[model samples]
Target: MKNYLRLLTHVLLISWCACNPCTRVESVDISAGVLLENGSVIYDGLEYPKSTWYEELADELVKRYGCPCIGRVCMWKCCGPGQTPFNGSCLDTGLAEVNPFNPPVYRGREPSNITAYGTFFYMHGHPCIDSYLVDTADVNEELFIQENGTLMEVAIGGTQWHLPTGYCVDMKYHNNSVAPRLVAAVCFPEENVSTDDSPLLYIAYAVGLLLSVPFLLATFLVYAMIPELRNLHGMCLMAYCAGLIVAFPFLAYLKLHVGRIGVAMTGCLVVAFIVYYAFQTSFFWLNVMCFDIWRTFSGYRGGSTNKRRDNKRFCLYAIYAWGVPAILTACTAGMQFSDNLPSHIVVPGFGSRRCWFVNWLSEFVYFFTPVLFLVVSNVIFFSVTAHRIRSIRQETAILKGAESSRSDKLKKDKQRYALYLKLFMVMGVNWTVELISFAVGGSNWYWIVVDISNIALGVVIFFIFVWKKKVRGLVQKRFRHMLGMPPVATDSRTGRWTTSSAPTEDTRISADETAIRLKDMH
Candidate 1:
């Protein structure tokens, strides 16, 4: 009985110890201070607030050991007051203050004297306060941001500063009348400024470009398969369409992958070159078409029915159309890679920003200037041709009693002129709007609509060149010839397929016959 009672007492003690675990405590050194549950530190029988105690402790530690103490933990103080630790050293947080009336001066060190961190460095400057600095040699005079996030150059009193971190500060001043002040401050990432388009805008842009591909392909195929459509004008059209075919896809791909394309990406540079060359070639070919039409109307008999002569002419046109753009592209590539060029001459920035012309200045200087010249040349050709056509019409009306052949020829020439005029108007209007939109510098609704229409240019070309009863008949004839069937009879007057028993020519025509047929069957 006594033994059982002793065992019960030991069980009660174990239960009591388990229920009151905090009753036993381990001893610790509290000579300096004791922290209470209420977050108060006690020393010398006096309680102090945690914050007050920590402040006093920090001061004492700093005074004794030259190290900062916070919350009773000592830390190495790397930066002095009014400074912040950055890049392994303390950087002054103050900006460079300067009076515009005074001479240009840097408070700390000049940008040239500062250590460059890769392509960027820091200098004491107001507005950009502690931001990464851009080399003055890198950017143009003044910086502005477009609605699409592109950086623009504006001349603001010839005083410009730049930040590499995509920050813009408007430093507009009117001589000594205005006090030195920061007008605006905006921070955007440089990469995002180049790459980030609205999702909807990107989708619309890509879809519109892709939508024209099938139509462009069909137009090229139709022109290629039909021997009757292989005249000089037809060849020029084919070349123009081919350029669009190559360019549209590459342009879309560049836009899609712009974010991934770095300044040094060789693939992007090649793609950019190809796109630039193809577009320039297309414009040149269009110019060739305009010039050829003008020459024909101006009574230049060089475009004869001789196959050899036509072939030679085409070769010349090809050289002009293909070779010029190639040279321009080569020059562009040279400028892009050349480090020897003077600072005043802006180099092409292909692949540096977004796999295309870097800024408005470079784009205008290299690409748009040439395009604008070509456009002006085309306008001149069209104007001269229009006057010639009016004279020819008047002459044909006067000689209407002479022969039916002259009337037929006039009709054909008018049709050709009409087609060229339509094509020119379409392309000219699109590009004019594009240039205007670019100059305006925004993604406005009207510009977006215009851009979409521009992307659908292949569809417009197909309708203008191929969506005719004559073209359909030609397509049918080609298919029937392939299937071992007799060629469809076409009306000699209307150039349309007819069920009447009319004399039909064989589908297999000689090169001379094909060359002689200059009029598009319509």
Candidate 2:
């Protein structure tokens, strides 16, 4: 039922995206006078085009949305207090009024086309526009002259384009007007990103992190309380997942709110370090699980009988994986914190801002390292499956001409397959959650995605274990007896296997014989 509901939800979201087209407005940041439309915040103020044609706009949209990439669908982050969708309203948590954003449509450098998009630093929903498009224009250099700002004029046969700092204009597709692509990005300084107020991205991250707690607690309980899971390799991986959940909240909080909360300035990065390594550890644990399955199922459990997992090695590796990312991030942060990164590397919509990945470089590596691991691990999963099939064939051959009972093999195959199923389910959930939110046009999407994925994974063990037919049948029988129902014939209406009318001793002996024969034959 849960799977069916998720499938249905995904289909509905895809259909909705097909039906709704986004609206865009020419939003001007008076402080920068940069134009935002499509996804690019036009940064080359001197290069603003006079006319916007379909071809130019199409190209920009593709780049802005990072289209053709089939992974996660993230939002076009805005300079708002809460990582609000990019409709241009800015929300400031504690600072004075936020950046000014005014939507624009041009009446030819005329003052008539400029409309205030919004000024207050509070979220007011996404702006209604697919971004902006403009046609041929002119530049009144004197129109927005302020020290370094200048306007330029360019010609394309009969038309001229003008760009003014504070002026507004609109353009549409015209066969006669064509211009090269203009792109830029929206960004705050690295200092601001690590500031005490915690910008929108950090806040968005914080919310997602904070919600990870329950899953983390659930995970610890799975290991700490459940005796069956204590040494089981699969459960160990689940434990790692639990560990990842715990780290997400802590790392994100440090990255997002540590400074704001008046914690140690350096502690932010330290927590971030732990977070990075923790994720790597989790991914590595997942890889270990695949290997364990291949080894155990293939009956190649060759390790010495008394040998157990090395707690010391586990701790050391965890430190190294995390320490490496921290060191990498720290070096990068030093460069970034010192106004490093190449200037020629320009990202559209960023305008003139000159940093990338910001201060939470650790977080980026933390989140994204899994993608690489996921790909490689998935390949290993298939390889392991293929190898197991080959082993089964060989083992059956060794038994030469004897009819090999396949039930045991089939059961093992299922256990192997379940791991694959769980990983695929997790990925699918992330994609569906992300894709739907993108179509619906909201940045609150991340919060929902993170929370749902964590909770769902923790709950999966229950359904997969408790809902299987044989397992559930036993549970039902026990429950029926507990409820004072006399053991009688099988409940045919519910199709439950009925207990025999024989005595308990006879039943026990029969069960033991069946078990022995089944084991020999299997």
Candidate 3:
């Protein structure tokens, strides 16, 4: 439980760093005309509430501007029955349809009524039917025209007519402005500015979690039902645990949606634990494999027999492999390491996710550590098999018999090595695709490829195990055991195997004893 909590903390730290929406669009202050809801233009000096000078000019624009989006949904009326403005003012709707056929009027024709608030065209309106197209409008200048309440950029092709109240905004930047402030409506900020939730993201998290629990159970049962799982290097086991821990965050997304940060934390912990476990398991297995060869491989019979007795050795390996990353991640959580190293927000396009063993600063842990294990384990696996090959060669030579057994063993060893290499490649491929996703545009296409490969990984693992006669049988029995089904006996001669629905006295002992007992049969 303590370990679980520690793992959860790590995840929250990483994810919190990476995926937060805090960047907001900066709204700059600009000196622009504000034609208020009451038809008064608050420009250089005027501050009247409802001046008739600007009111007449605004009314003329309402009769002209056309709707941009629908193109035909203009404020223009086809016949003379003009649509009623909601607020009985042009200030209410920014850019609405108007009677396109009506000639736009200007107050300057009656120049005696003109004021500092606004100037009108001589007689006819601008070409655009509904927009109050001003001759004074500059490029990217915040012009308060009627489209909505906010000020928008004034352009020949792009026009915003409605002004006042909540002033319209556009993608225009301003340096300095002396205009009186017109602030925001509310104090609080908004969330999810756009409505896209990236449904694939939720699906990815779900699928990852779904595979994790059952797969972890299955792998754990390998220890419980088959000795091979327990015989796994503690580093590898911890790595798997870390993977599971990290996966919890992605898993608890639905829960995270419900306001439970703690449950969300569980997801992070799972991945951390798995990373820690894998490192420990790798070295432990490397040592075990090496020691087997050093002791002359009595066919790994002796080593396999003393499995549980070697718990202390494995625990140490597990600690070393798992502990380093935990320490490194903890110490370096808030510190910036290098300029090139990508932060949580900017995921590295060429980095590894399962990188505790081979990350930027974890090079010692990631590179030398795993490589040592892989190289050492391969040597041990091959050395033992080589010893057998040599022994069989001598024995066959002595008896004038063929070394068919040696040949077959060598072939089998080659196949096993190839299988492991492929399995190792699953991580490489998955991370590589993730890296590519960060580049080639951080678009959905990159994620699509990465996600598909990850799902295919589990499928690949399943089929590989099924294809192996030995692993297939073991997996089936383990699945049955988890479902609380009656145990299927592997040994026909041992009547000690019973199908009773009730619990047995020495069930645990017999179960453990019979695990690799079927190794010969497979």
Best of the candidates, TM-score: 1
lDDT of 2: 0.39
Q: By descending TM-score, how would the candidates be arranged?
A: 1, 2, 3
Displacement of the residue 141 alpha carbon in candidate 3, Å: 32
The deviation in Å at residue 61 for candidate 1 is 36
Model 1, global lDDT: 0.61
Q: Please write out the lDDT profile of model 3 over residues 1-522, one tens digit for every residue.
A: 897666556655744665321111111111254667865545445342331221101322211111121211122221223322222222212122222122222232222332211321111111121121122223322333222212333322233333222121111112123211211111100121134345556566566656645654444345455544444332343344445434444433442232112221444444434444444343344344344333433442211234454566656655655565455444433221233332223221111122121123344333344544455455556566656656654444543344444444344433544444465455444554554443444445447656665545545544443345555555556677879888554444854444555533222333464332112111
Each prediction's RMSD over C-alphas, in Å, is 15.8, 18.8, 19.7
lDDT of 1 by residue, 323-359 (tens): 9999999998888887645556777766544678767
lDDT of 2 by residue, 1-522 (tens): 897667556655744654312212222222232445643334324222323211112322211211111121112223443322222333233211122333232343444432333211112222222122121222211121111111122211112232221122211112223331111121223322323232665566566556655645554554454322343443544545665675666665554542233221354445544564565555555555555455555564221211134344445445544455556556544543433234332111111122112222222343454545554565566577667766666655654454344544454454646754575456434544544453454344345545456435545544454345543444444455667765434454986566654433212322333232111100
TM-score of each: 0.65, 0.40, 0.40
Model 3 accuracy (lDDT, Cα)? 0.37
- Candidate that scores best on lDDT: 1
RMSD (CA, angstroms), candidate 1: 15.8
Superior by TM-score: candidate 1 or candidate 3: 1
Clashing pairs in 1: none
Backbone collision tally, model 2: 43
